[model samples]
Target: MQIVGQTTQLEAWVASRTRKFHINEILIIEDRDHRHPKAEVIETRTFNRYIPLASEQSNLVDTSVLEGLRSVGFDIEDEEIHLGKLRLIEELPTPIRVGAPARVPSFAEVEDLLIKRKPHEGLTLGVIQGSREIAKDMPESLQNVALLFDKENGVGEQGGVPFVFDYRSMDQYPHIGIFGGSGSGKSFGLRVLLEELMLKQVPAVVFDPHFELTFDQEFPNLPEDFRHSFKKRFVTLDAGEDIGIEFSELIADDIVSLLRASSGSITDAMETAIKALHKKSDSFLTYSTRMANLAEALDNEKEIREQSRDEYLNPNDRERVKLLNDLLVKYKDKVGGFSGTLRSVLRRLTRLEMEGVFTSAGTKKVEEAFAKRQLVVIRGSMYFLNVFAFYVVRKLYRKRRDYRDSIQKGRPVEEKFPPFVIITDEAHNFAPKGDVPAPAKGVLKEIAQEGRKYGVFLVFATQRPALLDDTITAQLSTKLVFRTVRSVDIAVIKEETDITAEEAARLPYLSSGTAFLSSAITGRTTAVRIRVSKTTSPHFKNPFEELEEGFAEQDEKVWEAVLPSLPIDASNLNAYLTEIGRKVGRLLSFDELEKTLEDFVDQGRLLKVSTPFGARYNKA
Candidate 1:
């Protein structure tokens, strides 16, 4: 150990020796008084004393003269110097005088200074950045906590160290933010974190719009011991597959939000109609029936007003009169008059019904997933995702909050809904910072502010954190930032985290699967290479590759089945498609068959000619 420069309680300049010091490397400083203080190297620089002071002052260094001096017996090489600037992490008991000795800490000293973990304190994430040597000597207690990739030493190497995060820290700071641009391993890191959560048996709901959270598939090269039986723990609510939610469960506000009602009159009118119709019948079909009845009543009222001066009434006048009277009496308060607003609201509601968003049977309840500790992945289009996510998040968060509130008030908790973590990849869409509100935003913001007490947490991942709600962003206690190129986003991250200018400069160039983790849990910023995912997304396959390897085998079978039915002479494309559909015993769309015909022409298997009547195709 050697010290060759000025020192202070907060900072020190240490002379570089044979052992090179790296940025973020921790070092211990000890003076003659025997007081040891810890500091982290933040900057490094090198200088040469061989350059004459007069030459530097004149800004005219003679390179030939310096080279001659160096060629001779001058000690120019010995004058070469390196220095490191270290910021204090731990203060000494007493103020250190100048010329304190600084040295690289031993494994035990490093463990005591930074790597030690309390009992059940934190989950191992990965090794600290720039601590490869010390990482090899991590304590045994943290070895099996979490398996992570070490960027410096590759996967599962000795340089790997336990990066632990205290779970208790979440009580005070609950939410987590994952920010990364495309190909930055944002989703991969999310999957790794999810795997850890699964091992802990924490019930979580993942809003997977792209249907990527199928954890059943085993990881490419993962060991048998690390593999999880995900099918038993995963509950997939796949849209247009097995997923269903009761339409009756949706409230008036939910319907209004779904339609994106902008006008106040339109929203009020829609809400009134929804509440009346929703109360009349719980089934979507029945609700439609009631709406049809209301429209019929409006038509009847118009008819009566126009024909009141008629000398004779219609044969079914009494039935019509009674029906209209009953409808008016029932909906007098709900629908004051059948205006265009009412019609628009009815049209939207009918469209929603046609979209088949709800069902009486096979409705997958959110409570079931929570009760069973299942990782529920709701997969669908953005519209369906937003709707389901809004309902599920709101219902679950409210239940947890109410349960906790009841317990606090000395009242018996009615529902025993377990706490859960809500995760969404496209979180900006769910809780956007724009003026137009998302239905999920209100409840998500509420959870962000108060979810910790209720044991609810949010793990929101987005490529564009700048577009995320400011309130939600502020509430995120931990932010894992992957490679981001946007200046605005980097600025936002800088404002939120304690990353230095040097670290911030590296944000755009960080490798895929590596991230800078800033969290209140660790009480510092760390660079971590995210671990590999045990299961990959089904849609992760390259479509172009699939095509190149021949994705037309199924189409060839259809062509073979239909070719025999085509006449030997030239045939109209539409007629050929119709005959093919009949022969195959399955109705094929004109557009689909037309594309197939075009492909056949491109392949020289069919010839198309513009005849006097129209275009015709024939086997080549």
Candidate 2:
């Protein structure tokens, strides 16, 4: 190949004898002085002199005309010339030489530009596109690294340079954002990322709203050596079952936030009532009792005012009246309007209590997994996770930040907590845009902005970038963008990352298991096909496939029991029924047995033989 167009400092065109060129392939521009600048092929074109742009009398050339041209040795295939438009990865002082020879470079030539860490040192996500030429010279560790997957063809053998991400760079760059639309590889790529974190034993907390992050089952078709068991390295916790809020640990603001999450909104009056009624170390019962008493006092205002003069009041009722009087006198100025405002708070509190958000054991299991440097997967519904994530993330982040802050200021170390990464899918629901308030948005936004100082990071994956909070989206330095078709999301991605217009145009057409890793850590945008994971989600089977398999299994059990006594007619139905029922473990009646036998015959699993007495059933 040779440079054939006007060469500029930023771009040059190279012509190849071959008919096609791979976009994003690296080529070295070898000049007389051997400056050896590298450039990436961003676009390609191929044409032939034998075939004109269009036939004279038609919009396109007919096949018969092509056959005639091939008969004379003027075939279009022979004259095809492939051209690649290459953009320099690093700019030069002057334009590249007009006739510089362009060839593929060795791994050593592009290793620094392409990779920041080794497989074990970083996250080996997948193979970079168009790196096969350098694969031969790659070290053993980088060769045949990841098994790429295609939805239509299944798995393909590993080749090309593996894209190992420098996750440690999060200390400087901070958070990661994963963007894509539905049916994109957004969730699949996330699963691979979490697997790498477990492989490295990095402490992480994952909020699984879909409950598909369980890693106990090994992925089918993975090679034996590549197989990994994550049962011990990761723990899945159900919100309000395995982990929840310790109600006594919550303050006034915590209560307000939980109520907002549970009911979607909290009025100013309700907030004021919560602050006045909820005391320190107040459990769910304590808080709920205060709310109930205030509402009762509002309902019986005349009775409360006249309780001191009542004649037939019992001692129990008299003492309760005094306590209500004391509460009303204490918070008369801090809050107002008891029944409507306090009753709203009571309803929210009661809903959360019934959901077990305040009753179940708190985040002890999550913290224990973090201390052991294991991945903790928190599973719950969208609303449940929203309610729990705020408390969990805020509490954990404080521990890590306080530890780091104490070390920085030379203060006495109180309690030790390790730094960890937080990951969540469908992240837009947790941190949405506009004026709406989400439960986890506050702490998540804080972590996104300043968590790097404390070694706390975030990995938020969502199908809609447009709906995510702007502040959090801006803080994500690394973006793994999968197939996104929505124009609104595409516009946001273009403005947020270093992706170009060409790449943005291709977003709607990208297939599953493919993504663009546009990262500040790499300082570039890379087209990547994700690798096959070592573990699969427990619910990987399609619902339709499961339905078919269930029927087939039931039919097999029935066939096994019927095979031994297949030649049964109406006369022997009673005699054969008992034996067949014993084998099948269910009582079979004459009509039920005969109908099933005829259905099997209709399905071609059995045949009916004509006899002197009647038709007899037999295996096909």
Best by lDDT: 2
Candidate 1 weakest ten by summed lDDT: 54-63
TM-score of each: 0.75, 0.91
* Total clashing pairs in model 1: 3
Instruction: Estimate the lDDT of model 1.
Output: 0.70
Whole-model lDDT, model 2: 0.84
lDDT of each: 0.70, 0.84
Separately for all candidates shown, the number of backbone clashes (residues 3 or more apart, or on different chains) is 3, 0
Per TM-score, the best of the predicted structures is 2
lDDT: worst 10-residue window of model 2? 54-63
Model 2 clashing-pair count: 0
